[model samples]
Target chain A: MLRELFNSENSVLYHVGKFVMWQKEIYKKPENWSMYYKEIVRQMYDIGIGSLTIVMIISLFIGAVTAVQFSYQLSGGLIPEYYIGYVVRDMTIIELAATITCLVLAGKVGSNMAAEIGGMRQKEHIDAMEVMGVNTSAYIIMPKIIAAIIVIPLLVSLSAIVGIMGGYLASIATGSVTEADYIKGLRSFFVPYNVLMMYVKAFVFAFILTSVSCYQGYFVKGGSIELGEASTRAVVYSDILILVADFIIALVLTS
Target chain B: MIRVEKIHKSFGEQEVLKGIDFTFETGKTNLIIGKSGAGKTVLLKLLVGLMKPTKGKVWYDKLDFVNLSKEELQSLRMDVGMLFQGNALFDSLTVEENIRFPLDMFSKKMSIDEKQERVNTCLAKVELEGVNHKYPSEISGGMQKRVGIARAIVLNPKYLFCDEPNSGLDPKTAITIDELISNITKEFNITTVINTHDMNSVMEIGENICLLHQGKLAWQGSKEAVLDSSNETLTDFIFASPFLKKLRNAAAG
Candidate 1:
């Protein structure tokens, strides 16, 4: 039994168990509120403001391409061309905005969180903090998780707006629909429930990405090679989990 | 005082530290000296409660360290400070901020001015006063180590731990760092435990030395006892180099 326990120490079950246990440490009350506040503010800037440009670029194209594709599909069919605006608006708000934007952010913010914390682990900064009686888990990770949870939903909201605007611009430029008709299409089927769905997906994905990435980085061992592997795994795992969560949320919510 | 009894550590199938008993003296530089893989680092980690031993009782005065509650461990941790091998100063924070970090986090009663004054005092104690605003990356390795030392002592910890404190420094700088740590231990009357293989440190500030060989305590004594001791493991480790062996032989002659 002892030998078996020792052999299983490096298994996936072991890491998963360890990860679950670490959450307790992460959620403990802050030793000092102001210190936590400062860290949270710094992380908010890094995640929210620092990511604005990429999110904008990706969201714009997603919106444009979506508009043009629907416009082409609706042309000469039983459906009216103005349906493109309705389709783009709903698609951007419901699925594309949160899902695609989070996938992009899972790569951007997730890898960054992993690298930053993994670098600290490698350099023994975490150890230094542990020695200083600082709860390394709460101090290092809580801020990042809180910042991501708060700001990622906001970013998703921004992406939805920007994507809708991009659809409007593309349709007008290509003469796919008249401006008045497109505006009418946008107004025709506005479901308030879909906005709620978008936020649910956003908040859930934000937690998964940030928490998984920080976990990958926090427990990293060895040197640069291990740190790099941890970072890559953070992105990959976050993406997969985000997709999985998206499917589950869609199933439960849409039903 | 810090004491360990019957300490045993194992990683997977490999046992690194066998049952051993030792006490670290307060107000002195107590060195855990051994060749690589002899479990000096493991022992240090066990003492600091970073990694628990497979079997052991570690004591800080009368309190049982290994079996403390979370609150007790945290409270114990506040009295402990460690200087890591890489110096581990936050790259983004200036030296002042680095030293002031623990004070800011733990000493909530201290005002900003009081914290700044403490930082300044620590820097001055380490004889590094002028570069408070410089980030850690902008400083030299030695200066970073000094900043690390200042930060470690900023909270006036009852115990100080140094892991390979002289690993990256030039010989002169290594001696300077060693002397600084020794002086701090004496001045603060802190229980200072140092894990190193540096002969210079083992000779200069080694008031008490514990040598581990093949996961057991091979010897324990003062710096003065090191040269006269006839233990084969001690001699082999201390005089592994030909030049050092010849010097020992000449000294014996």
Candidate 2:
């Protein structure tokens, strides 16, 4: 009984420690850049292409809803009506569109990658690769990480455009702001820095999303039960880490 | 040549292998057989450097396998081939890709044509010539096992380790796998180490049988000698389980 308890305890510690080892392994070989790039392309298709429609639809609605809310309040003279255009563009594109879109992606792409790779690990394909002289790091993890990086940036850009368009439609319908003024408001703050910050956040989020999900999947144990557990843990952990990473990046960019 | 010297391995306090000492030679099938939980599997893992021994050293010729550097281990791994019990073929790769996988990773000198030729040759060796494009899922369990064997030997490894090569196969297919392994061992002159609980395998390809019992080497001899050995523990072990006893009885009859 004591021995079984110790074995389980040891196994838990080993898995946690193995996860950290996998994280460190990412930087162990810089020569794997090209392989990683190819992997990213594959992942990009899954993350971006698969989830494009939903992200776009959600972005548009968020933009329209925000514009409608702002138009109602701004017409009463508590705030200038021109500010409605700014609120729609800035809040939708800069904050809500970029960050929240990624949060949604964390559930979709992150969980999918986790479940797929977790299933592979549980089935022992990963060990089979190692036996055949194939590098597991290059053969498995590199592709997923690369795909996420390529896909997330494109998804972010798509969400930003759709969100602004949604705001334009809502503003036009409500008669709170003219189309020219809405276009002007978007062009006015076209701060290269703001655009650059969005790109930075997308890239960082992609890296975290892929890495954490892959890590959770790669180390999953037992049978179907552990796989289900891994999938859940991957989504939850990646979601939390994405928020934390976004906050850190936001602090860095703003300061 | 593979040399295991006084190897001790334990999973917690269970002590799966206690002082295992054996040498597997080239061009012969070395079989490790025992009842379940007799440490045959653990010993196989140790031989292949998958699981490290607690109190001994395994020398692949001169290099201490346990203490080798990562790069060294990777290099050594190139010389080794392993067939898992479940025929652990990668579901993502087709049989052709799986066979060519090691060649792509370890050999950059070969042209694509050369690689393809080698894959065909290996596929042919396992009698799986035209089924190259099939995925593990698309193939039968026996075919998957053959593909697993094809993949293992694709690199033309110096040492071949099989963990229950016939675990789930029918008796006919299982015997065929044993014969195939034996033929390959002779043809390539590779040091082939097999871990099995099958008495059929023990009688057929077991050029040297190491019977392990409760984490100890209960007996070690050839198939001919195994029949006449006076060790009571070995007899009880061989005839202990009903399945093996039935096999032995049928063979005698």
Candidate 3:
């Protein structure tokens, strides 16, 4: 029991230390920030752009299913048919679009980051950096963090727009809602505070994904199995932490 | 000069280096040689600050490495260069960029042209001209090793550390690497240290040799003395293989 408890506590402390190291690395200027930027852009294209189609398809189906389910349930209620749009827009943007979508993106982006870095670690590229007097954290982790910071907001924005439109199209096609009434309903429920909350969650989710995955990769020991385990754990832990963080933020910000 | 004093390192229950005490002098190829699992690599890592010794100190000239802060360590690292066993070139970087990496890190005031010139100079030193645009994967193993060597010496470091510099090369290429290291050490007059199990290396360019047997200093001497040494263990080690015994015979002849 003590061994198990110690293992758990060690994992917690390891994660906390990893976050501190990542934060410290963010402000340290590397030899060539431009090269780092270009690398980040390349990764952004691979992680963000390449994964866009999958995220879009998932978001679309989710929006359509949510609208159809809501319309079927609320058809006989006092709430008008146009409230479908309100439900779709508000729910997708505030919760599903911002949080659930990010959870999925984290699985893609975060795991890949972990695996790539972990592979480099296994292959001794990070050791090469140390031998060359290049700070591995500054050179390797910075580009990744900066890339996630730049690309995540843009991805969240895209998901929001696509998901809302998917719901809008599904609702109008089913004859359960009209475009004008849906637009009016969406407008009525719109709040600047909700949008601000979405952005905040997006930013935090980005940090959680990049920092955790990079940390898992950074500390990878042993060989191939260890790297795969690190990537798998990175995705699982980041997903759970994103949900927990979202709830806390929702509680604080909604109050 | 690099000095390791009573250095000890352990991994959990297993101790790698018992009490390695040695001094690597300037302007020569100082080699650490031993059988596999004899703590040669661990001692080299301790000397280069790759890993901290569990029970002693490593010093560069007069500065004690154990007492240095992280910032001081970084400063010390700036004046040292290491070529890893695997020729760990960044796969993502091109040859020119790889050579220029150190210059970019430590010399901000250097113009791009000056950096390019330096890169070319280092590349030329390794006889790898016009291959700057190619990625590391595009290069041959020997070429990649040369690129690794170029990057190691690009900074004109006062201290050079190489771990198993010729492990994967053919005999001819290994000889070239050994000769290149000796020439660079002589030309730059830097304190160069190499760790190798390759007896060819021990015979070829080992100006100063430190033999480790199960983590203790077995013997220290020059390459010429290596063949005539009367130490039973050293003789057994040098003549253990037919190829090495033949080479020793040839040297004697």
Candidate 4:
């Protein structure tokens, strides 16, 4: 037991150190500006457009559920009826939109990145590129990170808007609160800093997910079974780290 | 010339390559022939700088590979080309793009027309012209290997490393590939190192052969010498199959 524990601890330390070192390599001066630019554009389209529908569906449902539950809790209370909209707005902006959207993306985008890179590694594509004098780490990974940092925040912002619209539709459709009351609540107690907080969370979560997933894929070994495991680990670790980072960001930024 | 001096490689507690020393001559087809698990792939990886040696040094014409910085290694790699066993063509890119990749990445000053012309020349050299727009999946295995060769030589490298270039191909196609590699090596006068277990390849283009047995250089000779050499390990390996042994006996008789 002691030996296994010690080995596991050492493994974690080794991976963490490798991850940091790999980041340093990934940011090295690119071989060609045009090639990197083209790759970044390709990744942007893939992450942004490829993920739009799923993000829309999940965010809409999450907002509707929050609205309905808040209406139920605030029923016949001393709190104003419009307070449901206010709560939903703040929740979506400060926490739900950025955190939930990113957690979901961590699963979707992270696993895809891992699988694609792992497949390349398995096929010796990475080796082929390495022999061609291309820095495989930077060529394969830097674009994904840059694209995610640029696009995920945009996706989160879109999710926020769609989610608020979902809350509005749900509340007014169910007749739990009048349309006028919800709109008034949304306009009240609106802090601009909450939007900043959401963007901050989005940027940090995007970085964590892309970098971790790329790292998992870049060093993958063995056959199909190992590749699958790496993909799963990418999603699982990215999700866990996003949640942990969310808590820390909330503590540090909100306080 | 590529020279490995007392190179050793280990993974954890297991040592894969044990003090291997050999020089691959320029303008010749150098073959590393070995059985599976004899560290052929490990040695190839070390030569390409994909994996570092646990001990000793690799020299590319007196530039010590083991001690080079990252930038220096990258610069060295610019003159290197490799063809993998699996071809390793990007599935998303068409044949033209695949061949054009090196030129695109490293030669920014070259115009698009010049790049296209160079790509065309490489494709023509491989007898793979008119298939440039097709993706890798759209092509047959032999054609894919040709495309791989086109990509490897697109930049006109000084050193070429091919790992199992004839694997999964028909005997005729394998011979054709061997002849193609031999022609390219002679035409360019570049050092070509091939890691293969195929006796056919050894007989065809093994100008300087190094046979490995359990991570040691078991035999080193020319293709003609491989047939007549009295090295036990080489004889045992070459005649491991009954069919080859019978052929050897018939030839001897």
lDDT of 3: 0.85
Instruction: Report the Cα lDDT for residue A8, model 4.
Output: 65
The sequence of per-residue lDDT tens digits that candidate 4 reaches over residues B211-231 is 999988888989999878999
Clashing pairs in 3: none
Best by DockQ: 4
The C-alpha stretches of model 2 lying farther than 4 A from their native spots are A1-20, A30-38, A173-177, B240-253
What is candidate 1's local distance difference test score? 0.93
lDDT (Cα, tens digit) per residue for candidate 4, span A1-255: 655554563477667767887888899899998899999999999999999999999889888888999999999899999998898898899999999988899889999999999999999999899889898889999999999999999999999988888899999889999999999999999999999999999999999999999998989989999999999999999999999999999999978
TM-score of chain A of 3: 0.92
* Per-residue lDDT of model 1, residues B1-253, tens digit only: 9999999999879999999899999999999999999999999999998899999899999999999998999898889989999999998898899999999899999989998889999999999989989999898889999999999999899999999999999999999999999999999999999999999999999999999999999999999999889999998999998999888789879
Ranking by DockQ: 4, 1, 3, 2
Model 1 spans with C-alpha error above 4 angstroms:
A1-13
DockQ of prediction 3: 0.54
The whole-model lDDT of each prediction reads: 0.93, 0.82, 0.85, 0.93
Q: TM-score of predicted model 3?
A: 0.93
RMSD of every prediction: 1.7, 3.5, 2.6, 1.7
Model 4: lDDT equals 0.93
Estimate, for each residue in B1-253, the C-alpha lDDT of model 2 and write its tens digit: 8888999998778888999888888888999988889999889888877678999989888889989998888888988988888887777779998888777766767888999999998888888878888888998888888888888998899999999999999999999899989998999999999999887888899898888998998899888887899887778866777987898789989
